[model samples]
Target: MMFLVIAVISTSIISTSLLPNESSHIPFLNDDNFLDWKDQILLTLGCMDLDLALRVDEPPEPTNESFAAKKNAYDKWERSNRLSLMLIKSHISQSIRGSISLSDKVKNYMRAIEKKFVSSDKALASNLMNKLSGMKHNNSKSA
Candidate 1:
C-alpha cells in the first residue's frame, strides 16, 4: 500500500511539470502577515505537488546496486528541493529577506521561519490566545 502511494505521488510529480500553465496566486509575506502567508504558501506548495519537500527531513540515500533507480530518485528530490526554495524566496518580502538569509533546504528554511516567528508551539498558542481574547466584539446586526 505504501509503495503504491509512493508510486502514484512520484507519477503525479513528474506529470505536474508537463501540465499546462497554472497560476499559483500566492501572496507575498511580510512582517505582519506570517500566519496568513504560511497558510497560503502551504496551499501553493500542495498545488505545485511540492509539499513533500517541506515535510521530508532528508531524501533516502541511493543504494550502490540500484544506481539508475537511485539516480532518478535523487534527481526528483533535488528538483523538488530547488523548487520549494525558489517558491519560498519568491513570496518573501524584501524587508523580511533583509533580516535573515533563507537556507537551501526547504525543511531548514521552514524551521528557520517557524523559529523566528513562533519560537515554540506553546508560545505560538499562547500568543494566538491572547490576541483572540483581546478582540472587541461590537454588537451590530449586518445584512
Candidate 2:
C-alpha cells in the first residue's frame, strides 16, 4: 500500500517534469481558422521560449574540424528545430495532418501554412479588397 502510493507519486512527478506543460493545451489548427490559429500558435511558441525556431533559419551544419563554439551553436539550433517541429505537429488538425509529410521541417511547415492561406501579404490584401468590393449595402432596410 505505502509502496504503491510512493511509486505513483514518483512517477507523476517525473512525468510532469519531463514534458512541457504548455504543450498539453495548445489550440489545434484547421483550414477555416488559419488566421486565428496562426496567432495562437505564435503566442504559444513565444511562451515556450521556442519562438526563435520559427523566426530564424536553421544554422549551417558544422564540419568535423569546426571549433567547439560553432558545433555547440549548431547543436542548440538543431534541438530547437526538433522541439518546434514537435509542437507544431502536435497542434495541427487531424484533417490536415495526413497531408503534411513526416519529413517536413519546422520552417517548411510554417511556409506550407503561409502558402496555403496567405501566399503573400499583397495577395491577402488583394483578396480582401475583392471581397469588400463585392459587398452590397441594403440601404432600403436601415439608415
Candidate 3:
C-alpha cells in the first residue's frame, strides 16, 4: 500500500495534489481539519466507487474449497482495500504522516486516523478548559 511521495501542484500557498484530480477539492487531513477531512474522505471514496473496504469487513481469504462467490468477495475487498489505503494516505499531510503507523487494511488505517483525531480533540478541549479556569468575567475588563 506504500506509494512513493511524488507530485505537486494544487492547494494552499504551496501546491496540493492530494486527490487523484486536483478539481476534486477534497480537503487534505491536517492538524486542524480532521472533521472536514473525514467527511470528504468518505464521500470521495464513495464517489470513486472504492469504498468497499469501508462498507464491508474484509472477507475471509479464499481457499481450495472456497465457493466462487466467496472468492469473488475476497477479490473485491482486496482491491478496494488496497486502493482505499492509497487514496487515504495520499490525502494526509506529510507532517502528520509519520506519526501514524502504516496498516495493510483500510479499516484499520481509518481507525488509527480517527484515534489521533479524537486525542487531538481531547487535547484541544483540555487546553481550552485550562485557559478558562484562569479567566474571569470582569464586566469592566475586555475578554
Candidate 1, residues 1-143, lDDT tens digits: the string is 99999999998776566443344446787756788889877877776677777776566767777679777877777788898888788898887766665578888887788777765556778989999999998999899
Candidate no. 2 TM-score: 0.62
| Candidate with more favorable, higher TM-score: 1 or 3 | 3
What tens-digit string does per-residue lDDT give for candidate 2 at 111-140?
876676654556778989999999998778
The sequence of per-residue lDDT tens digits that candidate 3 reaches over residues 1-143 is 12323322222323232345565577788999898888888877887678999989888899999999999999999999998899789999898888997899999999999999899999999999999999988789666
**Ten contiguous residues with the weakest lDDT in model 3:** 1-10
Off by over 4 Å in 1: 1-24, 60-66, 119-143
Q: Model 3 residue 77 lDDT?
A: 92
Clashes of 3: 2
Q: List the residue pairs that clash in candidate 1.
A: none
The top-ranked prediction according to lDDT is 3
RMSD of each: 11.0, 5.4, 6.7
lDDT of all predictions, in order shown?
Answer: 0.76, 0.74, 0.83
Q: Pairing residues by index, what is the TM-score of model 3?
A: 0.78
Error of 2 at 2 (Å): 11
Candidate 3: the clashing residue pairs are: 10-16, 11-16
1 or 2, which is superior by lDDT?
1
